[model samples]
Target: MNFKFHHIGIVVNSIEQYEKQMLPNKKVREVIDKIQNSKLALYENFNESYIELIEPLNENSTSFNSLKKFGNHLNHLCYKVGPFSELENFMRDRKWIKVFGPVPAALFENQKVVFYLNRNSQLIEFIISE
Candidate 1:
Protein backbone atom coordinates (compact mmCIF):
# COMPACT_ATOMS: atom_id res chain seq x y z
CA MET A 1 0.00 0.00 0.00
CA ASN A 2 3.04 2.27 0.05
CA PHE A 3 5.29 3.40 -2.79
CA LYS A 4 7.51 6.28 -3.89
CA PHE A 5 7.32 7.65 -7.42
CA HIS A 6 11.02 7.57 -8.15
CA HIS A 7 11.65 9.18 -11.52
CA ILE A 8 10.41 9.70 -15.05
CA GLY A 9 12.30 8.62 -18.15
CA ILE A 10 12.08 10.92 -21.14
CA VAL A 11 13.33 9.76 -24.51
CA VAL A 12 15.29 12.39 -26.38
CA ASN A 13 17.63 12.43 -29.36
CA SER A 14 20.44 13.00 -26.88
CA ILE A 15 20.70 14.51 -23.43
CA GLU A 16 23.44 16.82 -24.64
CA GLN A 17 21.40 17.83 -27.64
CA TYR A 18 18.35 18.46 -25.50
CA GLU A 19 20.39 20.44 -23.02
CA LYS A 20 21.95 22.59 -25.72
CA GLN A 21 18.70 23.34 -27.51
CA MET A 22 16.51 23.65 -24.44
CA LEU A 23 18.80 25.06 -21.82
CA PRO A 24 21.31 27.10 -23.82
CA ASN A 25 22.80 29.10 -20.92
CA LYS A 26 22.68 26.60 -18.08
CA LYS A 27 25.78 24.80 -16.88
CA VAL A 28 24.30 21.46 -17.84
CA ARG A 29 27.68 19.86 -18.45
CA GLU A 30 28.85 20.59 -14.93
CA VAL A 31 25.56 19.28 -13.55
CA ILE A 32 25.94 16.10 -15.58
CA ASP A 33 29.53 15.64 -14.41
CA LYS A 34 28.39 16.07 -10.79
CA ILE A 35 25.67 13.50 -11.47
CA GLN A 36 28.23 11.08 -12.92
CA ASN A 37 29.97 11.29 -9.56
CA SER A 38 26.77 10.56 -7.62
CA LYS A 39 24.70 8.46 -10.05
CA LEU A 40 21.49 9.96 -8.60
CA ALA A 41 20.96 13.71 -8.20
CA LEU A 42 18.11 15.43 -6.48
CA TYR A 43 16.80 18.54 -8.22
CA GLU A 44 14.16 21.03 -7.09
CA ASN A 45 11.44 18.52 -6.23
CA PHE A 46 12.58 15.59 -8.34
CA ASN A 47 15.27 12.95 -8.22
CA GLU A 48 17.12 11.93 -11.39
CA SER A 49 18.01 8.24 -11.67
CA TYR A 50 20.29 7.61 -14.59
CA ILE A 51 20.77 4.16 -16.11
CA GLU A 52 23.25 5.14 -18.82
CA LEU A 53 23.59 8.26 -20.93
CA ILE A 54 25.93 7.94 -23.95
CA GLU A 55 24.57 5.15 -26.12
CA PRO A 56 21.68 2.98 -27.07
CA LEU A 57 22.44 -0.27 -25.23
CA ASN A 58 19.44 -2.32 -26.29
CA GLU A 59 16.60 -2.04 -28.81
CA ASN A 60 14.64 -0.62 -25.88
CA SER A 61 17.25 1.95 -24.88
CA THR A 62 16.30 5.61 -25.28
CA SER A 63 18.85 7.14 -27.60
CA PHE A 64 19.01 8.99 -30.91
CA ASN A 65 18.42 5.83 -32.96
CA SER A 66 16.03 4.13 -30.56
CA LEU A 67 13.96 7.24 -29.92
CA LYS A 68 13.50 7.74 -33.64
CA LYS A 69 11.85 4.31 -33.69
CA PHE A 70 9.95 4.64 -30.39
CA GLY A 71 9.15 8.34 -30.97
CA ASN A 72 10.51 11.10 -28.76
CA HIS A 73 8.37 10.72 -25.65
CA LEU A 74 8.29 9.67 -22.06
CA ASN A 75 9.54 6.09 -21.99
CA HIS A 76 8.48 5.17 -18.46
CA LEU A 77 8.53 5.94 -14.77
CA CYS A 78 9.87 3.80 -11.92
CA TYR A 79 8.33 3.45 -8.49
CA LYS A 80 10.13 1.90 -5.53
CA VAL A 81 8.24 -0.54 -3.37
CA GLY A 82 8.71 -3.37 -0.92
CA PRO A 83 8.01 -7.05 -1.77
CA PHE A 84 7.43 -7.13 -5.53
CA SER A 85 5.69 -10.51 -5.29
CA GLU A 86 3.16 -9.15 -2.87
CA LEU A 87 2.59 -6.11 -5.06
CA GLU A 88 2.20 -8.43 -8.03
CA ASN A 89 -0.42 -10.46 -6.25
CA PHE A 90 -2.28 -7.37 -5.10
CA MET A 91 -2.38 -5.91 -8.57
CA ARG A 92 -3.14 -9.17 -10.39
CA ASP A 93 -6.88 -9.05 -9.71
CA ARG A 94 -7.07 -5.57 -11.21
CA LYS A 95 -6.20 -6.67 -14.80
CA TRP A 96 -2.94 -4.84 -15.46
CA ILE A 97 -0.88 -6.11 -18.39
CA LYS A 98 2.36 -7.30 -16.80
CA VAL A 99 5.25 -7.77 -19.20
CA PHE A 100 8.92 -8.73 -18.70
CA GLY A 101 11.19 -9.21 -15.73
CA PRO A 102 11.31 -10.95 -12.41
CA VAL A 103 14.90 -11.74 -13.33
CA PRO A 104 15.57 -15.23 -12.09
CA ALA A 105 18.63 -16.49 -10.26
CA ALA A 106 21.93 -15.71 -11.92
CA LEU A 107 25.47 -15.01 -10.76
CA PHE A 108 24.93 -11.31 -11.37
CA GLU A 109 22.44 -11.05 -8.51
CA ASN A 110 20.18 -8.48 -10.14
CA GLN A 111 16.88 -7.58 -8.50
CA LYS A 112 13.66 -7.96 -10.48
CA VAL A 113 11.56 -5.10 -11.79
CA VAL A 114 8.17 -5.33 -13.47
CA PHE A 115 6.83 -3.31 -16.36
CA TYR A 116 3.15 -2.89 -17.12
CA LEU A 117 1.77 -1.18 -20.22
CA ASN A 118 -1.93 -0.65 -19.90
CA ARG A 119 -4.30 1.93 -21.38
CA ASN A 120 -1.97 4.51 -19.84
CA SER A 121 0.47 6.22 -22.17
CA GLN A 122 3.45 5.68 -19.87
CA LEU A 123 5.33 2.46 -19.22
CA ILE A 124 5.42 1.78 -15.48
CA GLU A 125 8.32 0.13 -13.71
CA PHE A 126 8.16 -1.43 -10.26
CA ILE A 127 11.74 -1.33 -8.91
CA ILE A 128 12.51 -4.02 -6.37
CA SER A 129 15.74 -3.63 -4.46
CA GLU A 130 17.24 -6.25 -2.16
Candidate 2:
Protein backbone atom coordinates (compact mmCIF):
# COMPACT_ATOMS: atom_id res chain seq x y z
CA MET A 1 0.00 0.00 0.00
CA ASN A 2 2.82 2.36 -0.77
CA PHE A 3 1.69 5.56 -2.45
CA LYS A 4 3.90 7.99 -4.33
CA PHE A 5 2.66 11.38 -5.47
CA HIS A 6 2.31 11.28 -9.22
CA HIS A 7 0.37 14.17 -10.67
CA ILE A 8 -2.36 16.72 -10.18
CA GLY A 9 -5.10 16.40 -12.79
CA ILE A 10 -6.76 19.55 -14.00
CA VAL A 11 -9.91 19.58 -16.07
CA VAL A 12 -9.71 22.06 -18.88
CA ASN A 13 -11.96 23.12 -21.72
CA SER A 14 -9.14 22.78 -24.19
CA ILE A 15 -5.69 21.27 -23.73
CA GLU A 16 -4.24 23.22 -26.62
CA GLN A 17 -5.59 26.48 -25.31
CA TYR A 18 -4.47 25.83 -21.77
CA GLU A 19 -0.98 24.86 -22.90
CA LYS A 20 -0.73 27.90 -25.11
CA GLN A 21 -1.90 30.30 -22.41
CA MET A 22 -0.40 28.78 -19.29
CA LEU A 23 2.49 26.51 -20.22
CA PRO A 24 3.75 28.23 -23.36
CA ASN A 25 7.30 26.91 -23.15
CA LYS A 26 6.87 23.71 -21.20
CA LYS A 27 7.48 20.31 -22.75
CA VAL A 28 4.29 18.37 -22.88
CA ARG A 29 3.19 14.95 -24.03
CA GLU A 30 -0.23 14.91 -25.57
CA VAL A 31 -2.56 11.95 -26.08
CA ILE A 32 -6.09 11.29 -27.24
CA ASP A 33 -7.32 8.59 -24.90
CA LYS A 34 -10.32 6.83 -26.37
CA ILE A 35 -10.75 4.56 -23.40
CA GLN A 36 -11.09 7.51 -21.10
CA ASN A 37 -12.88 9.64 -23.68
CA SER A 38 -10.57 12.55 -23.03
CA LYS A 39 -7.57 14.34 -24.46
CA LEU A 40 -4.60 14.70 -22.12
CA ALA A 41 -1.50 16.80 -21.93
CA LEU A 42 1.18 15.82 -19.46
CA TYR A 43 3.99 18.00 -18.25
CA GLU A 44 6.64 16.20 -16.29
CA ASN A 45 9.14 18.01 -14.12
CA PHE A 46 12.67 16.84 -13.36
CA ASN A 47 11.51 15.12 -10.18
CA GLU A 48 9.11 12.86 -12.15
CA SER A 49 6.10 14.70 -10.77
CA TYR A 50 3.54 15.74 -13.38
CA ILE A 51 0.76 18.14 -14.15
CA GLU A 52 -1.93 16.45 -16.21
CA LEU A 53 -4.33 18.58 -18.20
CA ILE A 54 -7.51 16.83 -19.24
CA GLU A 55 -10.16 17.81 -21.80
CA PRO A 56 -13.33 15.91 -22.45
CA LEU A 57 -13.76 14.40 -25.88
CA ASN A 58 -17.53 14.48 -25.75
CA GLU A 59 -20.53 14.93 -23.54
CA ASN A 60 -20.25 11.32 -22.40
CA SER A 61 -16.69 11.80 -21.20
CA THR A 62 -16.05 11.23 -17.53
CA SER A 63 -14.70 14.70 -17.03
CA PHE A 64 -17.54 16.43 -18.86
CA ASN A 65 -19.77 16.83 -15.85
CA SER A 66 -16.90 17.98 -13.70
CA LEU A 67 -15.93 20.53 -16.30
CA LYS A 68 -19.51 21.67 -16.66
CA LYS A 69 -19.87 22.01 -12.92
CA PHE A 70 -16.47 23.31 -11.91
CA GLY A 71 -15.32 24.90 -15.18
CA ASN A 72 -11.61 24.30 -15.57
CA HIS A 73 -10.27 23.46 -12.15
CA LEU A 74 -8.17 20.97 -10.25
CA ASN A 75 -9.80 17.62 -10.77
CA HIS A 76 -7.94 14.97 -8.83
CA LEU A 77 -4.70 13.92 -7.27
CA CYS A 78 -3.00 10.88 -8.73
CA TYR A 79 -0.63 8.50 -7.01
CA LYS A 80 1.51 5.64 -8.18
CA VAL A 81 0.98 2.52 -6.11
CA GLY A 82 2.72 -0.84 -6.15
CA PRO A 83 1.76 -4.41 -5.28
CA PHE A 84 -1.34 -3.63 -7.29
CA SER A 85 -3.26 -6.48 -5.76
CA GLU A 86 -3.33 -4.73 -2.41
CA LEU A 87 -5.43 -1.85 -3.75
CA GLU A 88 -8.73 -3.42 -2.78
CA ASN A 89 -7.73 -4.03 0.80
CA PHE A 90 -6.20 -0.60 1.05
CA MET A 91 -9.33 1.10 -0.30
CA ARG A 92 -11.57 -0.93 1.95
CA ASP A 93 -9.50 -0.17 5.01
CA ARG A 94 -9.67 3.52 4.22
CA LYS A 95 -13.33 3.38 3.26
CA TRP A 96 -12.66 4.77 -0.18
CA ILE A 97 -15.16 3.73 -2.79
CA LYS A 98 -14.11 2.89 -6.32
CA VAL A 99 -15.90 5.16 -8.77
CA PHE A 100 -14.24 4.23 -12.04
CA GLY A 101 -11.49 2.23 -13.56
CA PRO A 102 -8.78 -0.27 -12.99
CA VAL A 103 -8.86 0.44 -16.75
CA PRO A 104 -5.94 0.71 -19.14
CA ALA A 105 -4.77 4.26 -19.49
CA ALA A 106 -3.27 5.49 -22.74
CA LEU A 107 -1.37 8.22 -20.94
CA PHE A 108 0.55 5.72 -18.80
CA GLU A 109 1.53 3.29 -21.52
CA ASN A 110 -1.64 1.37 -20.82
CA GLN A 111 -0.92 0.96 -17.13
CA LYS A 112 -4.07 0.40 -15.12
CA VAL A 113 -5.67 3.39 -13.42
CA VAL A 114 -8.46 3.45 -10.90
CA PHE A 115 -10.59 6.27 -9.53
CA TYR A 116 -11.93 6.49 -6.02
CA LEU A 117 -13.98 8.81 -3.87
CA ASN A 118 -13.03 9.08 -0.24
CA ARG A 119 -15.40 9.88 2.60
CA ASN A 120 -14.85 13.56 2.03
CA SER A 121 -15.89 13.18 -1.65
CA GLN A 122 -12.45 14.00 -2.87
CA LEU A 123 -11.59 12.23 -6.10
CA ILE A 124 -8.34 10.37 -6.29
CA GLU A 125 -6.62 8.38 -8.98
CA PHE A 126 -4.32 5.43 -8.45
CA ILE A 127 -2.07 4.23 -11.23
CA ILE A 128 -0.33 0.87 -11.12
CA SER A 129 3.37 1.43 -10.59
CA GLU A 130 5.60 0.47 -13.45
**lDDT, candidates in the order shown:** 0.49, 0.88
Give the distance in Å from residue 20's predicted Cα in candidate 2 to where it truly belongs.
2.3
How do the residues 35-102 of candidate 2 rate in per-residue lDDT, one tens digit apiece?
A: 87999988865477889999999998999999999999999999999856798789989999999988
By TM-score, the best candidate is 2
The ten-residue window of minimal lDDT in model 1 covers: 34-43
Best by lDDT: 2
> Per-residue lDDT of 1-130 in model 1, one digit per residue for the tens?
5777765555554555554444223232212222112112111222443322232334443244536677546567767778877778766866677765654311113346667765664567776765
Clashing pairs in 2: none
lDDT of 2 at 31: 92
Clashes of 2: 0
> How much does each candidate deviate from the true structure in C-alpha RMSD?
7.3, 1.6
